[model samples]
Every structure is written in C-alpha cells, then in structure tokens.
Target: ASARKKKGDSASSTTPPTPTPPTTVVAAPRLSAAAKGDKTDESDKGSDDDNDDNNDETVKAGSESDKDDDD
Candidate 1:
C-alpha cells in the first residue's frame, strides 16, 4: 500500500507540470501578437510622414506658380 501511495504522489506531481507547458505556449502567441501590433503602428507613422512631405511639396509648387503669375 505504501508503494502504491508513492506512485500516486509521483503521478500527481507530474500532472501539474504538464499544465504549466500549455500556459507558456499560450503566452508565446500573445507576445507575438503584441509585437506585430507595434510594427503596424510604426508603419502607419511612416506613411503619415510620407503624406506630410507630399503636402509640403505641393504647397511649394503652388507658391512658385503664384510668383510666376505675379511677374
């Protein structure tokens, strides 16, 4: 009976660690999702900066045309 109890205790101990691995597996995907979100945000900022540069160039071109008309 003592040997049987020891075997049961060992099984119980091993079962808890089996659940721990799944928890780590679940957390890994969450971290990867967060990293992807950050990359998307950076790309959006880069696109916005490009739009601002285009707007500035348009304004400069408009001003130059206005100067030619004035002359």
Candidate 2:
C-alpha cells in the first residue's frame, strides 16, 4: 500500500502541465492606396525582368533564322 501510494505520487508529479492554445496571430492587413501601389510596383519589376529575358531569346532566335536564310 505504501509503494502504490508512492508510485501514484510520482506519476502525478511527473505529469506535464496542460498546454495552452497558442494566441491567435493575424497578419497585418494592407488597406492603404500607397501600400497597394507598392505591391503593384514590385509585381511590375518582376514582369519587366521576365519581358527582358523573353526579348533576349526572341532576338537570338531571329538572328539564327537570318543566318539560316543567308546560307
């Protein structure tokens, strides 16, 4: 009976505390025109880079076709 009581006490002492649910974290919402403009500006920069790469490929292809025509 003493051993059983000791074992029960140890089990209860070793048990972990109940975990609390994490605080709800929300992203800062964008609601201003300037903030919207900033996003548009960033997107435009990406598209411009893509356009430049595509233009370079098209020019290379055009030059290669011209060389073929010459031959």
Candidate 3:
C-alpha cells in the first residue's frame, strides 16, 4: 500500500500542470460624436447660432476698427 501510494504521488508530481486560459479583455464599443450628445441636430443648431452671433460681434468690431483707420 505504501509503495503504491508513493508511485501514484510520483506520477502526479511528474505530470505538468494544466495551463490557464488567456485573459480576454473585451473593450466597450466607442460612442459616436452624435451618440455622445455633441453632434445632435438641436445642439449643433444652437452652437451654430451662438457662433454666428459671436462672428457678427467680431465683424462689427472689425468694421469699427476699419472706420477708425479710415478717419
């Protein structure tokens, strides 16, 4: 009995250990600019209007400067 147990133990110890499965890191899908709430129609229109207003103000200032230069 003792010799049989020793042989079994030696057989198990000689065998290589099973390899673990590789860790798969799956990333989440990337959100589009519209999905992220940046390029939506409402937001884009609002921003475009704000940009147009800012550009008008800048043009007015530029025209004033031009008038000053002309004077």
Candidate 4:
C-alpha cells in the first residue's frame, strides 16, 4: 500500500510533457514537390539523415555508451 502510494504520487506529480511522434517526415514541402515531378530520393535522404545523426551522437558519446543513456 505504501509503495503504491509512492508510485501514484510520483506519476501524478509529473508534469505533462510533449511527446515527439515516431513518424519522421523529411521535409514535407520537398517530399510533395518530388511526388509531383523531379525524381527525388526520400528514403535515401531520410535514412542518411538518421545514420548521420546516430553517428554524430555515437561519436559524441565516444563509445557504445549511447545504448545505456537511452535506458
């Protein structure tokens, strides 16, 4: 009962946070423009961006410590 009270208090007292949706839209305007015409690589660019970001973060961490930070 005491544990539950503590858990409830912790949960309720937490401020509402803005959650970033998992959907990754890479440049909506450019994507729509590409769909109209001009062969534009969307997946490649998005993947590359993700890879770059991951690499940059990994480099900053200086090792495999990123996995731990996520937890």
Residue-level lDDT tens digits of model 1 in 1-71: 99999999999999999999999899999999998999889989989998999999999999999999999
List TM-score per model, in order: 0.42, 0.40, 0.39, 0.29
Q: Kindly report which residue pairs in candidate 1 clash with one another.
A: none
lDDT at 20, model 3: 21
lDDT of 2 at 11: 76
2-70: candidate 2 lDDT, tens digit per residue: 999999988776653322222111222334566778978988897999899999999999999999999
With candidate 4 superimposed using the best TM-score fit, by how many Å does residue 5's alpha carbon deviate from the native? 56
lDDT of each: 0.94, 0.74, 0.71, 0.67
CA RMSD per model (angstroms):
10.5, 8.3, 12.0, 18.4
Candidate number of the best TM-score: 1
lDDT of 4 by residue, 1-71 (tens): 99999998777665333122222244566677878564346666778888999989979786557667776
lDDT of 3 by residue, 1-71 (tens): 99999999887776533222222211222345435666576777889899999999999999999999999
> CA lDDT of 44 in candidate 4?
67
The window of 10 residues in a row where model 4 has the poorest summed lDDT is 15-24
Q: How close is candidate 1 to the true structure, as a TM-score?
A: 0.42
Span of ten consecutive residues with least summed lDDT in model 1: 39-48
